[model samples]
Target: MKQMSYMINQRYMKKLTCCFVCIFLLIGTVAAQDKEVKLKIVQTSDIHGNFYPRDFILQRDAVGSLARVYAFVQKERETYKDNLILLDNGDILQGQPTAYYYNYIDTVSPHVAAEMLNFMGYNAGNMGNHDVETGRAVFDRWAGDCHAPVLGANIIETATGKTHFPPYVTLERDGVRIVVLGMITPAIPVWLSENLWKGLRFDDMEETARKWMKIIREKERPDIVIGMFHAGQDALLMGGKYRENASLDVARNVPGFDIVLMGHDHARECKKVRNIAGDSVLVIDPASNGVVVSDIDITVTLRDGKVTDKKIDGVLTETGAYGVSDEFMKHFASQYATIQDFVSKKIGRFTETISTRPAYFGSSAFIDLIHTLQLNISGAEISLAAPLSYDTRIKEGDVYVYDMFNLYKYENMLYTMKLSGKEVHDALEMSYDLWTNRMTSPDDHILLFRDKPREGAADRAAFKNFSFNFDSAAGIIYTVDVTKPSGRKVTILSMADGTPFDMNKMYTVALNSYRGNGGGELLTKGAGIPQDELKERIVSSTDKDLRYYLMQYIEGKKVIEPRALGQWKFVPEEWAVPASKRDYEFLFGKVQE
Candidate 1:
């Protein structure tokens, strides 16, 4: 039986080798059609650690493997019969099991992701916030070994102005001169680790893009111009101007460009924007992590004075416009097989449902994960977990390490703050207010909106309930009942030893520097705290990459069961619904009218 099985395996191996050769052969012969140079461009945005279908777990039926992407691209090219251009919108590194397991180890790095990208035909890539999360040294190495160009126009080293990554590149495919320019989101301060960008300077995206626009126009003038930007509609093209104006504000302002692919905010555009001059500048963006691919077919028109209008057969430009494919998924699995196994061992199951609810006011599944980790890592009596609600739901069976990092994506440092009960409550209120405000104004900033509150303006009362998650502070415990008004949510606050929060005494609370410095405006606003001053304040971001550190720790652990920290509860009554809006609960939690 063993001999027979071995022979069968050898035969299968030969067949697979033949298939691989055939794929390459087919890729090589792909030529521009007679009428036009039909080319396909595949782009992905904000793919944070969601590489495999079953996450990093080595599961077959799960979706979103890069191999599937490759297969899809191949199939598209076969049908379209066009030249191909593959562009990544950035935020590629540190998104999936690949970034978590191997990229962190330095044993395997972004080169691994890039290599897979290159083997599968990624022509050009850009820098994402998460890419910088790994630090410059690792990024530099990854850039050195990359198969495609890593691009950013404005990002320059502080001590030296040399770019950390390439700004743009011009390529020729199917007799069409295509110029691709790169721009990363300018939100460096908000998303990146201070250490990674300490001395570096990332200028206004438009200024940098314009400067490159002229350089490329004069030096590398091409037939078609395309922008590969990490900044998206919210940052740049918020459609109509609002309070904050950003670089994409200049996308239309730039001359000598045809189409632009955008990222950063990870929003799919409503449609292509046309300049006042009547030039339709095609623009496209796919939602993060290869969920959907945007396809655009470019056709040019030119004529002499005699011929009024002529439809000149040009290039048929294409990108990812569909779903997961078996071929792409299978190849992606084989390449990252090492990473797949290293992250997907069973982490145990949850007997209860975990959610990101109460994210607006009190605590959540996302918040619960944070506190539990901080308490465990720092061994602090009170661990502070800053609320950054993304995706949630921890169920039975194998949970990938990649999922763990996504729940706590930031490379933030954990610090402890000593505050009185009042101080803690005040800070909680402030964070809650920010959460509510962010939800209310959810256009360019919030791509995720599972939590929202209706008070509209600055309502100091968002903090009526100062409930701490069981995981929010390990050595501490608290409960909140929505039956009471907003501020009085917390009826009891006590230490693990059963000591209540005393007005005269102080307690040590652990949290991230972003919270301590009061980025959330909760503690910064001094809301509800009728005190003379803040007890103590200290700020620390991160030294080693926190995301990478977490990934390394998970591989060694027996299990990482994420659970719901039973802290806050909903009011018995439902909130009033605004006739102006749709299902209000989808945005804001059910408000008690």
Candidate 2:
């Protein structure tokens, strides 16, 4: 009986050992299957509504269209397959006539931008500051139409105190959990009118990132975390409360993020920054207008359903390599034709030709036209205007709706603010300080130029005065003496009607909403006007944008005549006369007739 019992026990033990071995082998196989996942993240940011390769404003072929991006994405999709995720970093809902048409004009129809993005299969998108500038109705509608989640983790709803958009999204691919959190620059409240973002509150980017990272790491235990920051690389403080460009700060302060994509400032960059955890994290910015796409490749390793190791790499993919996709064009061909017809419609006629290039030198019909319209509409005592573009021209005769876009590059509203004549002098002084350099001799380069010529390029002259900020006043006669120093450069002589300019007397100044809101610091820093008081000084504001008023003003007149007010001039004609001629030819490559 004992021998029989020993034999049964030995057989039982052998069977148990075999079962354990089989279970171990099965666990090993399952672990091996879930061990690795390869993911490719493709991104487009600051695409300011360039769905096509054509420049709707210029009516010519330009770079950085969604068609070009589609071509690249399609090719990349083939390589990445289901493991790929596509995203847009924001600033898409507004910009260009194409977007403006769909945003405000064609309200009943399906949004073209959203439709295209959905059709192309974008996994997610972030709301840029400019996107918020489009107002709640426009953005809310656009976001509702997007098939993918449109996220802004920091955009809090005032009533609910919760995120207006999805704060974060988690995707599972081959057992690897990937979490993406989206945040926009909190400077929306700083730059935009409060009415535009009335229901929403923007939180600091870095702070938002930190809070989300903790939650995602603890609850989701994500294999990888990616940050889609619709902010810039710069750490510049905006409104002294938050950083406008806080991507780098987030990367350094917030831990557990494997990748961060930045936008808003429209700079192309890719680098690695060590996180607080001392692990290298990749940060990339694809720049603006669909010119480039930020590509991130993440390699994750897992063992027994747990992540063992992970690595990520980032790079910017240029859109130039891929031409416009025929497939994409076919999809949006009808909408494209509609916009073409809309922009082609004649708005008014110009009495004579005018170009913005001349505005940089002094005053020209181009900027003066804007000044005339501002002064006429606002009925202000004086006007402040600037050349919005570097090299845009409107020829004589028929002008289309498209021409209006070139005339006004941005959708800035009209603002009439109260400023003392002394304050105006200080503002113009700062404007010319950026406009001109001290000229000791006639031969010295008058226009701003590069310190060194770029290789293989002809000695290209660049401007220290970003033509957009080269403000010149109308309704007030002033002299910018190049020989004088910055603070003393602008001398206000009298009003356009020859009334004596009084220093302490308050005058209503008509300018763009951007300037009135302190864009370029011409009013706040230069004029010594307090930033907080800017809103109080506003005498009038347009319900619609200045561009809209400009179009209406032209339509009413039928025959639009734009000419230089000649209210301001560069002094010391012996030096100014020749320098203007030389610089104009150098910059625009056209002879001044």
Candidate 3:
């Protein structure tokens, strides 16, 4: 009987030991499931084709580039590995000669922009207004070539009522699901020509975000939702619909977004805004040119396959601190050589040196050259042009293709639009209102000076408004009286050929597409043309960008001289001359001898 009891006790002990082992195994599994997962999301916006450290236009070393960004991203990937998410917020199709060459010149090869993004392992990208400005063929081809998805939730097809690009992309890492919703600024129609964004309509950010958030929550049920917007943070009413910079508005009004990344205004911002549910959402922008990147680290705690808690930290990391990635440069060496060769080719020769500096105080050869091109190409009676660059100079010598970039800053096509002579006068009035100040005395500032420059402001900070909007006429002679008020400052004397200026007469005017499309409101606000009617006035438009035509024009001329038209000047020379000199010194820190 004692032997039987001993055997029974051993069996009981064995069963008890088995129970304890099972409990231990269960606890281990639970602990593993309840642990934390970390992810790093890096964003680059408004890179504007600064792929290399070298400035293709200036032929000098620049501080920011995708080469440097790649170096920084490489280091970050060492820690995050598969958990690292890389995204680009558009405007990649314009700016440098590299993008221009790939966009227009090289039609057969895979765009270098796409190749670079793929090589850098970008997870996704968003379309920018400028990308749309490249027209459907270029952007569509670029999107098709990229391995990662190009998302644009708010860009909808007009015909089908469907999103033009993929609305969002779902990414999974370490059992955590992330949803990235992309949207571009809805102000594309205001700044871009209709043909550039044909068959597509930009939707409001707030409405689109609300719709996408509901779909994502009900369908995707993602652990985290991110907003990748190619818009600004500020909320400004544009075109009587959605705000142009609606990133901040979407973050505050919409729910379920864990983070929002913004661009397009070229302003750096980093802050946390509370959503409708009172949850903290991080909004960040690294500004433009790849000088900085938005770096975000997210730690998510999960239990039983469900997220219990999350911690997010964001910062703007400067790429200037990092060196250019050697691998990145070596891989794209051939493309770089091609762009270099393209920009370096001699186009023609300049008889005299020209600078945008004189264009501000009075007429200058720099702007007149553009006016000459426009009038000659469009056969317009009046030419409206501005000093696109605030302070850029081209010396007297052989001119390369790169120098054309300095001559004309944007890829705007030349436009020939019809306007009444009175409308032209009013447009000049508004231009001068934005450009000059009402000077009571000669000592007062000639150019409108800002009371105080905004924090972290760069060039053009001293001025009250944008230098690009300071338009001056070349085909007509006029004088701006400083003593008069804003509306009464400009006085049109006669046409360039001394023909009597008639306010009732309708005249053909040559201008850039940007102004023609009501970019600066010069046509709509000053000229008093309704926004809808501006398109009807387009008499003709160039087949290519103004810069391309300017190059061809220069090449055809072989040897050209650029001189100011002397068609316009400031009146009351005593007050104007002294004020102009003072303002020039104040703006550029030196006076032209």
lDDT of 2: 0.85
TM-score of 3: 0.94
Candidate 1 global TM-score: 0.68
Tens digits of per-residue lDDT for model 1, 1-593 = 99999999999999999999999888655532133444556676666655555555223344444544565677767765547677777777765556655555655434667666666677788887667766776666766777878888878877888776778888876556678888776655433345666777676677777788888878876777778777666542211122122434655777556777766554455355665456656666665655556555554322221212222222222223445556555655654667656655544444444454444434455566666666666565566565443324444445555455545555555555666666666554443333332222213222112233312111121223222211233455665333333355444467666777565566666666444444333454533332223223433333554554455555556456665565543222132113112223543446521
Which digits, one per residue and each the tens of the lDDT, describe model 2 over residues 1-593? 99999999999999999999999999878767756788899989988889999999889997888999999988988878888999899999766899989888999898898999998999998998778777788898999999999999999999999999999989888888889899998877556777778888888887888788888988999888889999877687745465778888998898888888888766678899898789898998887888788988888888777888887888888888988999999989999999999899998899999988778777789999998999999999899988876677988999999999889977778999999999999988888887787888987656656564332112122664356677889999888888887798888888999999999999999998778877767887788877788889998899888889999999999998888888888888789888988887877677673
| Candidate 3 minimal-lDDT segment of 10 residues | 453-462
Question: Using alpha carbons, what is the TM-score of model 2?
Answer: 0.91
Give TM-scores for every candidate, taking all chains together and pairing residue i with residue i.
Answer: 0.68, 0.91, 0.94
State the weakest 10-residue window (summed lDDT) of model 2.
Answer: 452-461
Better by lDDT, candidate 2 or 1: 2
Give the better candidate number (1 or 2) by TM-score: 2
Residue 582's lDDT within candidate 3 is 83
Off by more than 4 A, model 1? 1-39, 57-60, 79-82, 106-110, 236-248, 276-278, 301-334, 345-366, 379-383, 386-391, 395-411, 416-427, 434-509, 513-593
Best by TM-score: 3
Clash totals for all candidate models:
29, 0, 0
